[model samples]
Each structure stands twice: as structure tokens, then as C-alpha cells.
Target: MDAGAPSEGWPLDDRGVAYGDGLFETVLVRDGAPRLWEYHLARLARGCRVLGIPMPAEHELERPLAQAGEGVMVLKLIVTRGSGGRGYAPPAAPAPRLRWQLSPLVPDAARWKVGVRVRHCRLRLGLQPALAGLKHLNRLENVLARGEWSEADIAEGLLCDGEERLVEATCMNLFWQRGGRLETPRLDRCGVAGTLRAVLLERLPIAEVDAAPGVLAVAEAVWLGNSVQGLWPVARLDGAGGEALQRWTIGAVHRRLQAVAHEPLGYPTRLDD
Candidate 1:
């Protein structure tokens, strides 16, 4: 919250941060632009309609994002109810607050070096059919998942449902190479339907399977995919802490990512044209 920032735009409402009655999209900005604008905007429009918020013009957000800095940037778009009175009741014809922030996307050292160290988080993802796959603002579940282990060595944590079914990684979707086929968990009942995950489903030969906790043990390779993280390898995945950057190499995984780094959605600049 900078001093120059308007207080009204930030909007405080019981339905917003309190109830997560809002939607957001963290657009992957690459080479000074955001990738997958169409998909993000479509999801935003649908979320706003469901939450009863008016939709903002897409180009208003995209124009600024297209003119961002180079190398990896992240454009986070948040829309919420503009300052509501204390009550569960909706604000009649509430003005929607549109907030956009630009931040540098961490270049994912996990993918470049060896692989990210991951562990099973204690937090369990509860199923909510209505808000199951929506990228809403209520992220206490992900917050708790990442907070499960605070060690600097830990890159990410795997979250599972109460039934031990794999939901997703703390902030990304999970994909594994099993039996010469790519399998990802069906996020119908839980987890965020990530933009990258949606693109992968369209572009790659993948199948939605019942990816539970057991899938990790038998799968030949495990990777966490996200708009920001890209595709990170799971080098060391266990409860107990292990060695840093072991002999195991994820070069094959890295090469695969390199092959498709700018292929998904045909780069971010396409949206600008």
C-alpha cells in the first residue's frame, strides 16, 4: 500500500478478503508481456458473474500488462467488491474494485538447477463444488499448506484431500509421468484450475486420473506446473529432511521444459497484437 495508492481502489469489504468473494489471476509475464490473457479474462468474467460483480474491460488490464518490463514479470489482477458495509448481505449494484500489480517472477531456480524439495503438507483440501476450481481470493488452505514446513530448503508442499486424494501442490498443479502417459488429477471437486494446467490439457496428450498420494510413489517422474513456476522437478520428496542437490539429475525434465518454454499459448506477445 503505497502513499500514492488510492484507498478506495484497494476496497475493504466483509465479502472480499473475509469471505473470498472475489477472483484473481496471476498472469505469467514473459519478455515484457502476459501469457494467456484470453483464458484469464474468460475465467475472470465468469467468476465476477457468479459473485455478482460487474466485469471490467479486458483491454484496460491487458494494455498495461503488455507494456511491462522484460525477462520474467508477473501481473496479478484482483477484482473485489468496492468497500461494503459490515454484513453478509451483498451490496446492491456494488462497484467492482479492479487492482493490478506488477512484480518480478522468480526465475524458478528449482527447474534450472536440480529439482525442488517437496514434502507432504498436513493441511487437507476440503471439497467445495461451487468454489472448487475457481481461483478465488480465499487462500487460507494454500497459506496453511506452505506454512506446514518453513525450512528454506523446502520449495513446495503437496496437498491432499481428507481422503488422501491428491488435490495439487500448494500453489500449482501436479503432473506425473506414469506408465508412459501423462496423468494429472481431476480438479472437479477441489484445487485451483490453473491457466497453465488448462493449456497443458489442451496442448499435451494428458489424461485426468485419480491422482492420489499413492500416485507419487509409483510414478516414474513428478513435476509441479504453474504459470509462474513453469515446470519444476521433484528431486527429493520425503517427510524427513534429506541432502541438498543429491546425485539424482532432473536434466531430462529441464530439457523438456526448454522445448516448450515459449510454445504454450504461443507466447505472451500474441495477445498484444
Candidate 2:
């Protein structure tokens, strides 16, 4: 797998493109090694089991992952149900297609250190418990939510469900500290269960809860995170019309979590740097 050409041949009628029948994993590769490899695979396997898509062998992925080479890069792997019968019907015997690409990781040190301003998106995610936490290919809801704002200063947007219960950000998982308690949105109804979120759940005393968007007003600190970008503290949150909803200064709790993330995940320790 050359850096210039990361993907294999893609068929025209592949189900991944036609019906969005596939799962993807974005892995962070540092110094020719993939970070959180097993967690990513576990999530992928879970998605495969849920969607009835056959899981590819570990060796099949290891080969291309090894070619990611040195320096920091992002490895995007896609496994689709392959070409199937016309329309929504899947093939009796499926041959899953594994496509992958490697690209240079973008730097987000400024956002990580100084914190970012986020907005609340008007777009609400629909409930689908069966497909709640899988990284599936149907991401139009996220696509539209992310497009709600184009301001350079607004780093991300927070999304809610139809009932106005906070779910997650457009691309990252949501977390916050309130009264010295760490809490994150419950993804059992919808939203992607990010690999980094899983790691934090295992390592920290975080609690998963269902709360309304108004809960942020009382939060001590807010955060948005993903596997690739680490964690970003929220300096401010704005409404749909750009009205200030809440604000905060990046404090000790964020730094403490960054320290915990740094050791196992390789996030920068000195965020102010």
C-alpha cells in the first residue's frame, strides 16, 4: 500500500456505496504502529456481528497497517458487504471488501491547549438502538449537523436526539464535569461509541447518563473527544443563532484527564505548550 495510493479497486455496485452497508474505523498510527489496535478491532467485530457482515481476518488488516510507515498518520479502514443483488437485498453468500487508506494526521494542538468554542446544532439525531454505537457508513445526519456552522472559531457542534436529550458532537463523543463528577451522554439510543470513549470508561470513574442540553449550563467543564484527535476542552458553547449559552476556563480536571490519556494514548502532556 503506497502512501500515494492507499485504496484497492472499488467496484461500482458495491453495497457500501449503494446502500451504505459497511463499517469503518479511523486508527491513529504513530511510528509505524497503530494505537488502540485491539479496541478498534473489537468495535469493528461487534459492528460486523450486528450488521451480519462477515469479519475479515486479523492478518488481512495487519498487512496494510504495517505499510503505514513512520511518523504520525491516520489509517482509515472500510469493510463492506461487497457487491450484492440489485436493491436492498443482500447476497446469499457475501464477500466482504476491505478497503484502506493512510493519510497524515492533522495537528490540533491549539484547540487541545487553548480549548474550543462549540455550537448547538438544530439537526437532531434519530433513535435506532439496533445501530446505536456502530461506526456504520450511513452518516448523513452527522454530515448535515457538521455543516450547520462554518465559522472558523467554532470547533464543533453538539447534537441532540428528537426528545432534546444530548447525544454527542457531530464527529466526537461528548463529556463534561459537573460537581466533580464526570459524565458522558448515553449512546445506547444513537451516536457512535468512540474507541477513546471506551478507553476512558475503563480507566476512569466516568458515568454514562441521559441528560438534556440545558445540563451544560451547570457543567464545570465540557469536552469533546475522539480516538484520532484526543480530547479538546470546551471554552465556550453557543446557541443556534450564535448566542452565548455557557462559558468556562480550561481547568485542572481537563489537565488531569489529558495526563491520563497521555500515558496510554500518547496525547501531549503539556497542553499549554
Candidate 3:
């Protein structure tokens, strides 16, 4: 891949664009360096395993990654099982396709300062245990949910499973704080198991719990997290027609999580820097 041209574009018969049959990772780059690189690769590898797509070696991507991530940006890596036959059956010995790009990242400083307002999405994520947590290309549910709201103030939309259990936000993982502890939705059934969520689970007092329909109403604080944006404190959550349903204050725990997010990821420079 060329530095100027990240992709040759996908073939018309590519499985990824065809049936949403691939996985992707969005990594953060800061000052010409990639952040949390190993974790990103691990997540992409896991996604490949679950999808039956062969994982490419890290060295195969180093050049292009270094080229694209020449500055602060979002580097997206996609692995498809290549172009395949028509219908559901893939090629027996399918060639895997790798594509990547780096796009300029615009920080949401206002939300980071005053906190973000989220609304409940009308669209519910369907349960697919096999695909859950993979960050795969099948994201029509997210697209619909994201399109549900157009207000400038509503930073994100929360989604639930078919059973009305909280899954996650349109683009990030959900975390609720109570009694100085953090609890997040279990993604075994659905939702992406975010890379930042993984780091928090390993380093913080966070638990995986089932988020019932009204769980957020009683929580003291709520936050949305992903690798790129770090953590976004949720000041309010609302339902359709902009009806106020739950409100949370940006409390000590929120600040603590922000600190944890900024903590060095064993890198010379801070990951959040």
C-alpha cells in the first residue's frame, strides 16, 4: 500500500462489503506514533479468530501504519476474507484482504469538559453471540441508531439488546458508576468489547454486569469509553422526544477514571497525550 493511497478499493465481490464479513480496529495515533499498538493488534487478532479470517502478521502492516500515522489521527485497519463467491459460502482457501487509513481526529473538547448528553436509541441490537465483541464490519444497527438523533447537543445514542438490556452506545462501551465502583454491560451476548474497556477491566475496579432496562436511572454516574476518545462523562440520558429519564453528576469516580485513562500505557509518552 502507498502512503498517499491507503486502499486500492475493495472488489465488487469482496465479502466484507458484500455480507459485512470482516473485522476492523480503530487505533489512535499521537504525534506520529501509534498508541496502545499491541492491544489493538490483539483485538484485531481475536476478531479474525472469531470470524474465521486469517490474521496478518504485525510486520506486514508496520510500513503502511507508519506512513499513515504520521500525525495525530485515527488509524483504521480492516481485514476481510477477501473477495469470494456469491451466496453465503466463502472460498475454501480465501485470500485475506487488508486495508488501512489514517483520518484526522477532531477532539470533542466541549464534551470532555462539560460532559455529554446521550439519548436512548429506538433501534435495538439483535443478539449474535458469535459476532458480539468482535468490532466486525456488520454495523447497520449502529448506523441506524446514530441516525436516530441529529441534535448537536446529543453526543451519542445508547442502544439496548432485543430484550431491552443495555448493550452500549452507538460507537462506544457503556459504564455506570455507583458507590465508587464501575460497572459495564456484559458483551457476551452483544456489543463491542472496547479496547479501553478491556484496559479498565484489567486495571480498575470495574465489573461486567447485566444492565437492565432502567439500570442507568439509579446509577450515580455514567460514562462512555473507547480507545480514541478515552472516557466521556455522561451528564444526562434521555429517551425519545427528548424526555429526560436519568441524570448523573460528573463525580469523583468520573475524574478518577479520566486519570486512569491518562496513565501511561508503558509507553514513553502518555497514551492520552
Candidate 4:
């Protein structure tokens, strides 16, 4: 199904809608099979534990996901604490609601081949270690950051935390190459720990660090990654004043990373491969 099959419209008491109390996963489905299914489920389970919501059984989600049909598509799974009362307190025994949605998988490899432009977002991510790295329902910061850009050519917006340290993009994990070393922002303080980013960190010799804005000026190349769109090399980066801060050619490093980006996520791929 293209959307959720809830018996009724959104209940007024749904904790997800009311307080943004839920966890979600966006999976890549190919030929009726979910890619990186285990990783996605693991993240969801971790989120559920953090939010104190009952985790849905694996088969409960697999059954609905299999109904998405064949071919490449984006499958979204959401688990919320169902209906709740009119306060900040959560229900003791929560009955979680599972919702699934499907959407077409449009390719952007053509644009990625040339590279894409990214700009600095004025909005800063709040540092909340408790909520950091979880794909929970609360994403107002991302929504506001993404809203800062209206240009269609600007593929994504780079974000920084309140301390002015580079965290990630609005909806993707960030990676940059410097002196032949690959480094990405450490999501220990804030930012979503995307499934693809996890896989890359495990497979590639990438370092997780707190990068500042100045790091981009010296970077050989920058990348934005997500499960749905994969990895996109940055052609240019714009500062807060809309001035070009850095430019990178789609070089050998990007080509090599792009190769691994297309590999199946069955196991932790060796970096030497």
C-alpha cells in the first residue's frame, strides 16, 4: 500500500501526533525484499527501548512490508505509543500502533555523477545526548533547517550544533575527505545515526569527529548519505553569506566510496574491497 491502512483517521489521542512519541525507519526495498532489514529493525528496537514503547515483533513488520510488491521502493515503518491521555505522562501499558507506507524509488545518480550543491543552514541542532542518534518522531529541528533553503539546486543543507560544530546535513549523515582520510561528524551529542552511515563507518576506515565549519574549507570532497538516496558527492559548499566556501571535483575517493555504496548490505564489507 502507498499509505497506512489504519481503520480510522488519526485519533485525537495518538501520542505520535500529539507529542511526537514514536520511532520510524525508512527502508530500501528491492524486488520485494527489504535491503538491510536487520539493521533497520535493530535501530527501531533501540529507539523503542529509549522511548519506553513496546517494540513490535519482527514478523509483525515483515508481513506488511512484504505487501509492498516488487521493484525498488522506499518502505516506511512507524511505531507509536498509540492513543494517550491529555498530558505529558505516558500510559503505563502502551499499545503501540504500527504503520507502513510505500513510495517510489527515484534515482539521482545522474546529478550525483556531476555532484550537488549544499549550503550552511542558519538553524542549529540542539545538543541532547538522551535523544541523540535515535530516529524518533520529534524532528522539528530538521524541519526548520530544511525550510531555510528553497533552491531546487541545493541538494541539502549542512547543519551545526548550538556550539557551532558541524553535525550533519538536514536529512543525511555527512562525510568529508581530508589528506586522504575520511571523517564524519560524531553523533554522540546529536544527529541521527543513519543506517547507511553505520554501515559505512563499520566497513570503511572512517573517523568520527566533531568537525567545525572551517574543516569544509580544506576538505578534498564532502558527501551526504542516507539509505534512500545513498551517497552524493558535494560539488560546492556555500557559507552563511551564500558565498562558495569550498569546491571539490568528483575524484577517485568519491568513485571508490560510490562503488561500495552500491554493494549489498548483507555483511560488513571489507574496506580493502
Candidate 5:
């Protein structure tokens, strides 16, 4: 593995840059060890198989991760089908390129403890089952949704699909409690299957369903989560016009799941006042 500078130049015709033909993973590193390492690799491998890109050996990826040293940081790994092809068609034999960069991570302690404010996005995600769960390079939809809000207090925007089914947040998977049951959107048709969501699915009894946005209004509680931020309880949900649509109080359920994520992701545990 090469610890080359992230500023190094790549060919302009690289498939990842030309047509967004690539996969990437954002890993959280703490004290020189990456959290959810296997899960991240598994997701990357799945994406490579789907995109027909070659998957590099685990040892090659581990060297960069081990160099994170002490303190918290984020490591972004990108794998692309190296430059060379005819028009839109890929080359007969593709050589994959692997690049990784590490940077310091600052924890959001206040948001984790007091919860965050979120709003529904007007932009809807288009369905593509083939690329549904992979964190591929194409992210225009998320970029647009995130741009919908510029308020410093609004932490995230909830995205739904064209079919009116709530999908996920701009950058995280969403979960809510309603009717005495824990439910999350079904990502089979669209949305990124976040690593932390994968971990909770294995350890908890949450159900995946195709539900409408109205469910959130009646939900007992709502939360948005990802590998890097762990879990953030949703204190309020607003509409595009800034109308309060739903609200939740930070409670036991939030702390319970925080405890579950704390072990793997190192999120700080907080007690209810």
C-alpha cells in the first residue's frame, strides 16, 4: 500500500471522474483502529462485484488504516476503474485504482446529547435497484437535497422517493418508532445501506418497511444515524416552509441504542437528566 499524498493528480479521463464509475467508503478511525472495518470492506466488495471493478486485497487496505495513529479521524477510500475506454463503454480489461485519505474528525457532542432538528426535502431520489445500496460516486441527488437547507441549526434533511415512500436522510439511514414497533425504510429499491444501520439490524429486532412520510408525524420517536456520527435523536421535523411537522423528546430508547452503538463506534454515552 502506498501512503501517497491525496493532492496527487489523476488522469482527467479516469472513469470515476469522467462518468462517476467508482465506489467509496468513509471509515471512522479511533486510536489507530478503524471501527466496523469488516462491514466497510464487505460493502466495498459488494459494490465492486456489482460494478465489475476489481476488489483489492485486505492487506493493501489495512496499511493506510493502521497509519491513522491516535485520536479520531475519518478515512475516505475510493476505488475506480482506471482510465481507458471507448466513449461510454468500459475497456475490455480494467485495472482498478485505489486511493485513500485520512483527516481529523470532530465529534458532535451537543447534537448527540440534546438531539437535532431536521426538515423534509422537496427533492426525491430516483429508483435504481442495481445501484440502490452501494455508496457509489454519483451523489447529485444527495447534494441537491442537502442544499435545500442553509440554516446552521438544521442538521439534516429527510429524503423520500418518487413513490412517496420515505427513504433516508441526505447522508444517513433513518429509523423511527411507531405503534410500539421499530421501523426503517426498505432500501431494496434505493438509498445507501449505511454501515451502522447494518450493525443495528444484526443486533436488534427492527423491521424494514415501505412507509409514507406521514408515519413520522405519528412516530413515537425518530433518529438519523451513520457510521461516523453514530446516532442522533430527532428532536423536531419541519416542512420545506419551516413548519413543525413532528417532534420527539430525548428518552430512554435514544440512550439504549446509543449504548449499543457506543461499543462499536465509540459514541459517548450520556445519562438522561
Candidate 6:
């Protein structure tokens, strides 16, 4: 649990908790240290700028991270417009709330070995270019789709936009192997551009397209990515899947991603000098 106060406590009323007028970033921390800390902070700062809220320093969240205990972990940082009155008008002297949480992260064992099963969700995403790529708090759509499954076997669920085009998985970005190259949905109009997705595009040769819904069903293999999971393969698909959807279809990119996630410290410094 976070130790930060309710500088914008209830009765005070924060617009974020009240109206989902905020942004968040889930960072992947290993051991007692954070990975790509600056990158995650950069994105969070940008999100605050987008929503017109001032950014909080990383140390502001250090207390919660310390309380998080140990091992691989997830750190969530939420910043919202603090204490509003009645209307949507900004507070005369707004106090932005910085709520943070850190907790142990133990991914399903199967994910590391065999990947996980997934299905196409019925809930379609709404197109909102303004908020398409940012990690905002108004995620009723993701929550609804994620709630569609109760069983633990269902590792993730794919989502289509209002036009029935593949956008992404519930909380991760999607990537498909077409026997030659990698293809993924463009998040310009919908979906969150994941941190791992940014790394892949910046590091590998990939494609950004408005993938048709059937691509997941027809692709040779599929995978999903986020900062935490890196890139985990999709072992099985329950739909009009491709040619029986070859089992354990681990592509080159999949292996590369796994290596990056598990051994980020040993990774070669490929960033241009």
C-alpha cells in the first residue's frame, strides 16, 4: 500500500478517483531496484502534462516502493486533479494526488514455459485518438472485457475496436508472426502503446497496421507484450484459428523478448551513441 497522503482526500475530492481524470504507469521492478525507471517516469510525466496535472518526482513514490517488500514487483503511480467542488472546473488551488503502490509479482508458471490461452472478447473498444495511446485511468472498457473471463486458464483476451479491427490485448500490445515479418495494430486511434512495444519497434523490424480481426485467427503465431511480461506467446487461441494454430509456436521475436525481460541487465547496450 502507498504511504502518500490524501492531500486531495475525499470531502476534498480528487477528479481522478471521482471522474477518472488521471493517468497511470505500471512499472516492472526487479529485486529492490526499478528497471527503465526514467522511461516510465517520463511517460507518467507526459501523461500528467496531457491531463493538465503537475508531475510528481520519482522519490515521492520511493516510500511505497520501499514498503513493497521484495522480489520482482509491480509499481503503479496514479496522479489526479485533487479536490474539486461541484462542476468540472479546475480547483482554484489544485493539489494533485500521487497515489502509488508496490507489490510482489509472481507470473503464472505456465507463462514462462508454455505461454497461455486466450480468446476474442465480445466487448469492443471505443475509438478515441485523443486518448488512444496514453495510459489514462478511464478504463471501463478494459475492465469490462477483462471481466468476461473468470477462469484462470484464460491468460489474456484480445480486443477489437468499434470497427471490429484488432487493437490489442486487454492490458498488453499484440504482435503476430506472418512467417516473414511481424505485424501489429496501429494504436493511433485506439489501444495503449505499451512500453515493451516501444522497445520492439525501436529495436526490431516490425509492422504497424490496422490488422483485421481474422489476422489473429489466421496468423502463424501470436504474442502479447508489456513491460512486466515482456513478450509472452499465445499457446492456444479459441476462435477461427489458423490451420489448427500450431502448438507452442515460439517465433524468433518471442525468444528475443523473453531474453530481454529475464536478463535485461546482461543485454547489450545497442542504443546509438
Q: Against the unseen true structure, what C-alpha lDDT does each candidate score?
A: 0.71, 0.88, 0.80, 0.83, 0.88, 0.73
- Which pairs clash in the backbone of model 2? none
Runs in model 1 lying further than 4 Å from the true structure: 1-9, 240-254, 265-273
43-62: candidate 6 lDDT, tens digit per residue: 77777777777777667866
lDDT by residue (1-273, candidate 1, tens digit) is: 111122235534435676677788888777775687777887787777777888877656665565576777887777776667677777887766676777886664535446677788878899887778888898999997787777887788888887778888889888877676878888888899888887778787878877668777776677787867666667778652433322234656434643453366343211112
lDDT of 6: 0.73
Q: What is the lDDT of residue 148 in candidate 5?
A: 97
Error of 2 at 186 (Å): 0.7
Model 6: worst 10 consecutive residues (lDDT sum):
264-273
Regions of candidate 4 where Cα sits further than 4 Å from its true position: 1-9, 265-273
Q: Which ten residues in a row have the lowest lDDT in candidate 5?
A: 1-10
Best of the two (1, 5) by TM-score: 5
The TM-score between candidate 2 and the true structure equals 0.96
- Candidate 3, residue 173: Cα displacement in angstroms equals 0.5
Cα error, candidate 1, residue 217 (Å)? 1.2
lDDT of 4 at 232: 82
What's every prediction's RMSD, in angstroms?
5.0, 2.3, 3.1, 3.5, 1.5, 4.8
What is candidate 1's local distance difference test score? Answer: 0.71
How many clashing pairs per prediction, in order? 0, 0, 0, 0, 0, 0
lDDT of 2 by residue, 1-273 (tens): 111235456788889899999999999888888888899999999999999988988887766767877888998988899988898988878889888888998768888888999999999999999999999999999999989989999999999999899999999999998899999999999999999999999999999999999899999888998889898999999998899988898978788877666555676877765
What is the per-residue lDDT of model 5 for residues 1-273, given as tens digits with 9 covering 90 to 100?
Answer: 222456665677788888889889999999989999999999999999999887878977776866798999999988888786758787778887778888999978888888999999999999999999999999999999999989999999999999999999999999998887889999989999999999989998899999999998788888899999889999999997889887789999888877776678987766464
Candidate 3 lDDT over residue span 25-141, tens digit each: 888878667777888888888988877878887876565656654456888887888888979897887788888887898777666656899999999999999888889998999
Rank by TM-score, highest first: 5, 2, 4, 3, 6, 1
Candidate 2 wrongly placed segments (more than 4 Å)? 1-5
